[model samples]
Target: MRALCWTGVNETSVETVDDPKILNDPDVIVKVRLTTTCGSDLHLLGGYIPTMRAGDVLGHEFMGEVVEVGSAVQKHQVGDRVVVCSFIACGQCWYCSQELYSLCDNGNPNPALTETMWGSAIGGCFAYSHALGGFAGSHAEYIRVPYADHGAFPIPDGVSDLSALFASDAAPTGWTGADLAGITPGDTVAVWGAGGVGQMAARAAMLLGAEQVIVIDRLPERLEQAHQHIGAETLDYTKDSVVAELKERTGGRGPDVCIEAVGMEAHGTGPQYLYDQIKQQLRLQSDRPTALREAIYACRKGGSLFALGVFGGLVDKFPFGAIMNKGMTVRGAQQHGHRYIPRILQHLADGELSTEHLATHVMPLEEGPRAYQMFKDKKDGCVRAVFQPNGASSTSY
Candidate 1:
């Protein structure tokens, strides 16, 4: 089979690779259908993540048809069209019982596992890295899904991959971030970044009953899209001061809830610096604070600061006194995908959320590199891109 493999920092190539087989009793093998690139994949490409190696397949979010299953996989079977959970987990783990499958004792089924490090042998999507569990990604003809009973959810009837795909990661991650902020009816919520996750977080805040949702980003196209389609108010961080605008919009007190969806790959980088960092340990950041340092100061004293963005390693200075004086709650967790995918899918089935708008770009899997360039260059009005390997790919795209 041909798979998109990370050859080195700032490089990837489509290479022929071995087919995956069921290794765990609860595992299933799925023929790749609709696999998309994620912002997280950019980290591996840019070398922000140290564990990603040459030849590591790098995709996580996907929906496909089950081609085979192990005897222990009782909940599903071959030909079951399903949305593969981004996080590999055993539903029976202590963490899973608590609905924290991202922290499941059996984490990703990555190959670089040490007995102590891999916990109880659960894992996340392929190509993410050992830190996320080194499962080879689905940017190929097929993928191996471990903890199938725990992670994969059947795409409910009447659902399209165009919409169902977000259930794998972006929408749920947004929902988790908004929920962590403890949004309440009529509360003011400010979200940083206007990407799929950010837009979804804004939408999630709205769905959770926030009176107003303010999204901050530099891209006019994305900001406009967020405003026009998702019913969000917008602030361009580059053109305006996010803190002042956000505070003024919220009537002097900043949003009651603030979510940072932009991860460590801080925006505003040229190719040289971007490439230099690709092979080395690069700096991580909190774009929320970068956009609204005043958010900490301007928050409603007891407001919530939700950092849903992934941080690669350490961070620079943050306003400790601001946090101390405000007495706000701060929380973040990986998308507990298994816990939310089902409910999120149900919402999609009901037409409450439409990922079709979020998918601004779509192409064949062979254009994976170009998709990355378009997304990195911030071209093609790209918010997110999906690659379809099989002829059975979604019709809308």
Candidate 2:
């Protein structure tokens, strides 16, 4: 099998690998139809997240056809079109029973690293890192899906493959933020970063009956996509004062809900950003929380803030004062897709959600290296680069 492998820091390549076989009774094999790069993958690519060894297969968000099923996999069979959640959950654990699937106790087989770092381990995610179970990812012709009954959701006939692909991660991640952030009807919501997850979060806020939703980013292309495709107001942070503009737009009260979707590598305009970069590069901090700090300060008093972004470890200059002084509710989580994927798929099937636009570049698996470069550099207005491993042509889409 040919798959994308993380060769080294800031490097990736297409390499031949052994095919996956069913290892658990609830496992299934999926012949990947479409897989896309995610912003979180950048963390691994840059070596910010430790324990990622050379040749670790890359990718997580994907949709495909079931090629084989294990003895205990009752919900799916061969030929079933399915979208698997990036996070692995056993579904019968205490966390899974409580609907907190990402915190499932049985997910990450290699838990020593995270347990040592964060005091306890979270769930496993496909190809995230060795700290997250070291499962091969979906960026290949086929992938092994464990806990198939809990993790795989069938794509509805009305939903296109391109549309269903995001249900595997991005959309459900957005839904997780909005649903868990305590978004209320008629509330004003602001989301930082106009990427796929940010745009999806804005859309989820709108669907949740937020009176107004705003997406902020430096990229005009993504802002335009948020405005035109997601029907949310867009803010260009580079051109305007984000905090002041947000306050002015919300009648001086600020946004009732603020979501930060830009993770550890957030870019900013001032000395603070440079300082964070220096600290991160020197190993003084594992993450840069520029957008997160801004989100906290910009959030209204008594409002809710959700960190939807992926932060690996310690960050300097966190705004603990603002969070404490403003009486804001703060929360963060990896996507519990099992709880939200069903509704997201229904939304996609009914044409209520649009994700095809996020796939700005679609290409063959051979272009994996170039695709990652383009995606990481944000070149050519490339929002996401989708890879097809089954001899699918780039022009076919």
Candidate 3:
């Protein structure tokens, strides 16, 4: 099997590796049909997340057919088409029972590693890093899925592979942010970043009945997609002051909900961007939180702010004062994909949600390295670079 292996910072290659086999009673082998690069994967490529090794496979969002299943895996069998969650979970854990699958207590194989950094171990994630879980990623012909019954949701009839592929991570993560923020009718929402997750978050806000949906990013192509596909008003942060533009648009009150989907790799402007860049280069801070700070400052008093982006470590000069003075609610989580994938699939089946446009660049898995480079650079309007391991039909170029 050929897999995309992360060899070093900003380096990856396609290397042949051993095929996966069923390892536990709750496990199954999935022959990957489709997989895609995520913005979070950019964090891994840029060395923002820690504990990655030379030979680690690098992918998390994927869907496929079940090739083999353990005896205990009764919900699925050979040939069952399904989308697996990016994070692993144990169904019997207290958090899983509460529908917080990402915080499952018994998922991460190496809890001590994460506990030292984040104070506790999160649920195991496919190819995220050693601290999260060292599970092999999905950017290959096949992958071993643990706790199959809990994490794998069957693709409903009529949903294309392209649509189900994102339900694994991007769409669900965006939906998680909107759901947690409690978007209500007439609420105004602003999302930072115009990548797949941000686009989905903007669409989710509108679907949840928010009166206005605004997307922020520096990229013209992404902003155009937000305007054309999701009916969102877009702001190019590089061209306009985000805080001022947001305030003016909302009649000087700011948005009721602000979502930070740009994560640690946010491109900042002016002094803060320069300061964060210098600190990051010197290893003084693990995250560059330009978008997060703006989100906090731009949110209305008593509003909600959700951090949908991946932050591996501590940030410098976060505005705790704004949060305190304004009585804001802040929340973030890895996508609880198990809790949301099913509903998203139903929406896809019902023609209520369409993700066909998000897969902007599609190529065979052999071009994994180039695909990632284009995605990371946002070249040629590459919103989501999807790789078809089986070379299945694609929706777009």
Candidate 4:
């Protein structure tokens, strides 16, 4: 087998690797058909995630066909096409019983936890390294699906793999963010960042019945995608002070709900002191915190602020005061992927939710480097790219 292996900061490539087989009766093997580089993958490339290591398989968002099934995998069998959940979790865990699958006590792709819970440590889903259980990722020819009954969802017969690809991650992640924001019919929502995740969040807000969705980002192409295809009002952050501007547009208070779609690799000019305080010493390098700052500042009193973006470090000057003073509710979570995958795909299959417009490019998995470059530089028409494994056929819309 061959896979896109992590090779330290700013490096990766397709390389030969050993084949994987079922480790548990609940497990199944997936022949990867399509995959993509998520923003979190970039964090690994930039060395922002300390747990990632060389030889680790990369990629989490994927769609594939079941090649083999463990003894207990009764619901799935050879040739069954499925979309993988972003994380592997036991459906029977205490957390999963409560719908908190991402934090499942026995859930994995995390080594220490796996060792603690299962009496030993083993790998998890592909590409996410040690901190995440070092599972071989979807950026490969094939990957092992642990907790198969829980982690793999059957793709409907006519649904495009391309369209359902995002149902695995972005679509559900955005769904989680909107749910946390407590959005209601006619609520005014404001979202930050216009990445694949952010654009999806904006669309989800609309589907949830938001009367107004204003998306903020500097990328014209992304903003245009939001405005034109997504039906959300767009704001170019580079052109103005987004915080002040959002408040003005919202009538002196602020938006009813604010979603931070940007995460730890967020960048800004600094005196070195600021960067050191927020990034180096504490380890959170994502700009989502800064967007959180804006969210707190711009959210209407008694409203909500949801940090859907990943936050990796302790903060020095976070807006604790505003959150306390404004009486705003704040909540967020890693996508409980298994919990949402089915319903989100139902939306996809029905044409109620379409991310086809968001996927701007597609190519062979061998083109990983070129795709990374396009995303890092925010190339126009490069909002998202899907990786089609050689000799594998899967449509991600």
- Tell me the TM-score of each prediction against the true structure: 0.91, 0.98, 0.98, 0.91
Off by over 4 Å in 4: 109-126, 268-288, 392-397
lDDT of 2 by residue, 240-277 (tens): 98999999999998999999999999999899999999
Candidate 1 residue spans exceeding 4 A from truth:
109-125, 268-289, 292-295, 392-397
lDDT of each: 0.78, 0.94, 0.91, 0.79
Residue-level lDDT of model 4, residues 61-90, one tens digit each, is 988899999999878999998999887788
RMSD for all candidates, in order, please.
3.7, 1.3, 1.4, 3.4
Clashes of each: 10, 0, 0, 22
Report lDDT (Cα) of residue 177, candidate 3.
96
lDDT of 3 by residue, 175-230 (tens): 99999998999999999999899999998899899999999998888898899988
Q: What residue pairs clash in candidate 2, if any at all?
A: none
lDDT of 1 at 169: 87
Where is model 2 more than 4 Å wrong at Cα?
A: 393-397
At residue 343, give the lDDT of candidate 2.
97
Per-residue C-alpha lDDT of model 1 across residues 259-370, encoded as one tens digit per residue? 8887766553345334434423433332213433445655677889888877655444567778887888878777887777888898888988777787787778888888
Clashes of 4: 22
Best by lDDT: 2
